[model samples]
Target: MQPNQHLRILTISSMLMLVLSIYMVFVYAPLEIVMGAVQRVFYYHVASGWIGALAFLITLICSILYLATRNLKWDHVALSSVEIGVVFTSMNIVSGSVWARPIWNTWWTWDPRLTTATIMWLLYAAYLMLRQSLENPQRRRTFAAVYGIVAFVSVPLTFAAIRIWRTIHPVIIGSSDPSAEGNFEMTPPMRNAFFFSLFTFTFLYVTLLWHRIRLEQLTVQVAAMQSRLLNKLST
Candidate 1:
């Protein structure tokens, strides 16, 4: 199939899955006895957080490949992944803050998990800024790959902050510390909804990544064509 046709299919599928996930989150999932409707946010919030980490992992892998092969294609993939990662991480942070307002009684906190997440987002944001500062394509790609690899250290740290230290953040999937707040038991339907939301987000991520990669490819082609046009005009 043509590239446009494939993108169209992906767009349709992602939209359908998104709609289903929203319904599952709001209507199908059982309401929490304590948190009520606000708890529903947990489904997409956790999923977006997971996707953010996954995007960083993709960047890390692409960075490694670019460093080893010095391939521009890998650099493009790494850049696209980091761009997507930043957006998803921003979503995760915003949703967490929204959820925190009612549960933690404040919109912001210096809790371990929240603190590390903010730092991680800043690190990646800096990575983008670093790329913008460099003009030489080779140097830019090299520095970006190195920075991307180094920045990934924050992802694991952010994930483990809650587990390693005492925090008010809730642990949903695994063994929870006694001090963990906002923790709740999930019913069967809730579990199903949670997993479905996760799958939906993963699918969405793949679709977005594909589109972003294509955009990067088109950008390179346009740049090359422009360079050729300038050279011909100078002659």
Candidate 2:
């Protein structure tokens, strides 16, 4: 099969899984006794958070590969991953705020998980901005690789925040701390839906990453062509 055909298949699979996941969240899963309808947000919320972290993890690995091999392909992958990670992290944070308004009585809090997540988003966002400020392409990619590796400290830190510090954030999967708010047990159907949503988001991430890598490659080609044209015009 052609590359586009393969991408199409993956994209279609992601869309179908996304539709099914929505049905599961709204129609299949049981409603929480406490939060009522708002609890449904938990499905996508957790999935987005998972994708966000997963994307950053990819960037870290690619960054390492780029530094070791000095391959521009790895740098391309790292940049694409960071861009996707930022969007998903933004979704995670926004969805959390929407869910929290009713449960926590406020839209924002200084909870450890929340704080770390915000910081993680900002770090990656700054990474993108850092690329723009640097004029030397080689210097930019090298710096970005180093920064991407260092910034990944936040991924583990954010993940462990709820576990280590006193926080209102709930760990829905494992045992929850007594101090944690919005804790709930998942029924069989809810678990199915939750896992399915995670699978769907992973699929979506793969599809998006493929598209992004292609776009980045095309961009590099265009920029090179423009530079060539400029030199010819100057001569």
Steric clashes per prediction: 0, 0
lDDT, model 2: 0.95
Residue 150 in candidate 1 has what lDDT? 95
- Tens-digit per-residue lDDT, 1-235, candidate 1: 1379888899899999999999999889988999878899899899999999999999999999999999888998899989998998999999999999998899999999999999999999999999999999999999999999999999999999989998999889887778877899999999999999999999999999989999999989999999999999999
The window of 10 residues in a row where model 1 has the poorest summed lDDT is: 1-10
TM-score of model 1 (CA atoms) = 0.97
TM-score of each: 0.97, 0.97
Candidate 1: C-alpha RMSD to true structure equals: 1.3
* Pairs with backbone N, CA or C atoms under 3 Å apart (clashes), candidate 2: none
Error of 2 at 87 (Å): 0.2
lDDT of 2 by residue, 197-226 (tens): 999999999999999999999899999999
Clash total of candidate 1: 0
Considering every candidate listed, which one attains the maximal lDDT?
Answer: 2
